[model samples]
Target: MTKLLITLLSFCFIQCQGQTKKNETDEEKKTRQEAIIKEHVYDCADKIHYTTQMYEYQKCLDEGIKKDSTIAYLWQQKAMPYYKARKYSVGKPFLDKAVQYDEKRWLSYRAFMKCIFSKDYKGVIEDFETCIKKYGNSYEMDHTYSFYIGLSYLQLNEFEKAAKIFKQDIEEQSQRLGEGHFLDLFYYGISKYEQQKWEEAIVQFDKSLQQYPEFSDAEFYKAICLMRMGKKEEASLLLVKAKKDVEKGYTINEDNAIYETYPYKVRW
Candidate 1:
């Protein structure tokens, strides 16, 4: 009985020793990976600061994320370069991880906004839906989210979806600033134009002009829509007027409105 007890004790000791060694090896591997991740992250960030070449920096950060999922900020940082580089496919994944960790909501939103500029309409819709669910009530959040949602749908050729949101935006603006607001009409006209609802677009532009007559770009787009609707005479008149205004230094580069926010100047 004594010999049997000694054997049992010996077996238990061996098993425990093996378990400890395995655990230690796993921890050592994890630590090594973390160190590697940290080095790559710093290198990438430095490169981004110096060169502004986001694609190369993003490559380094992507490797870091694969090794150490704990570094949430790395994911967000990784996305910036991809976004600026116009690599939406690569950027979306990292930004997706950043949001997954729940550490950088605002950064994630900004990254997603950049994704919209890359013309990733599906990504914009997916990310915005989550953002609205997560932070719907904040005014900034609502405006930013809704605007992107509408913009994304517009890009995706989902005009009906954009039109619905623009309609809601108009109603919201009306309640806040009262009716006949130029901004409300302009945005509504934008939505109508996206939908190829040319007549409605013309009406909205006319309403905007009623409030802000010097909105020459609105006049230009209105003319384009009128031309699309086979109203060549009306379009010609508006074009002549727009050309005169441009010569008078009165025309606005409708595309330049959001130059600061968007990396690329939106042509339409």
Candidate 2:
């Protein structure tokens, strides 16, 4: 009948099954419980997606959380809408709950949100540093933990520190993936640009543009670097190209960019 009752019955059924299998390993029992929790948590997915009201979406998540308060997915789902709406304070408690229940899964994500959405650079560094200690250079939202840590330093105007971290990140990615991510190159460029290392910044920007030829932000910053070097004519031509590309929607295209402006993304 009701979703909560369904979840309870499903959970009970799994428990009973576990009882019959006295030889069930602890890992196997944990896996079964997690599978049941995931099914129960995802049962509200359709309502969460289609509901026109925030309260209705939250109601679905709240019901799941009530059925099993340990389900971190329920807490994350409850928090996300508020964060998307820029209601960070309202969403934070629920997000904190998610981290509390499943730090391994949610901690780095929380750090990314802090860096991008809340602009909490200090908190971003702390969380990402903690994640790195535990997970060893793990990725979140498609970038390494060190990438956000570098972005945090950039935001804090610790330009040299940012540049150092980005360099390490780029070298590691290059070693493992055979190339650095385009955005990582772009931000590494930004770090050098902040330090007035015009030629060095342009080199990183050129690398980024080589990967993503129409990357408007890379072009924009490269143009600025040229201007700083007194190459005004070349800078002017690049700026024109950057403007046209931006008008054609070829800017920083990260998924979260749809929700929030990325650091150093040029408006024009």
In Å, residue 31's CA in model 2 sits off its true spot by 7.0
Residue 150 displacement (Å), model 1 = 2.1
| Cα lDDT for residue 20, candidate 1 | 65
| Model 1: per-residue Cα lDDT over 92-211, one tens digit each | 777767777763355436534554446566766776676667766223323445666666776667778877886776676667668634654666687788768888988888988888
TM-score of each: 0.58, 0.86
lDDT tens readout by residue for model 2, 119-138: 99999999999998988999
Decoy 1 TM-score against native = 0.58
Q: Considering summed lDDT, which 10 consecutive residues are worst modelled in model 2?
A: 42-51
Error of 2 at 57 (Å): 1.1
- Model 1, stretches more than 4 Å misplaced? 1-71, 103-111, 137-143, 177-187, 194-196, 207-217, 228-234, 240-268
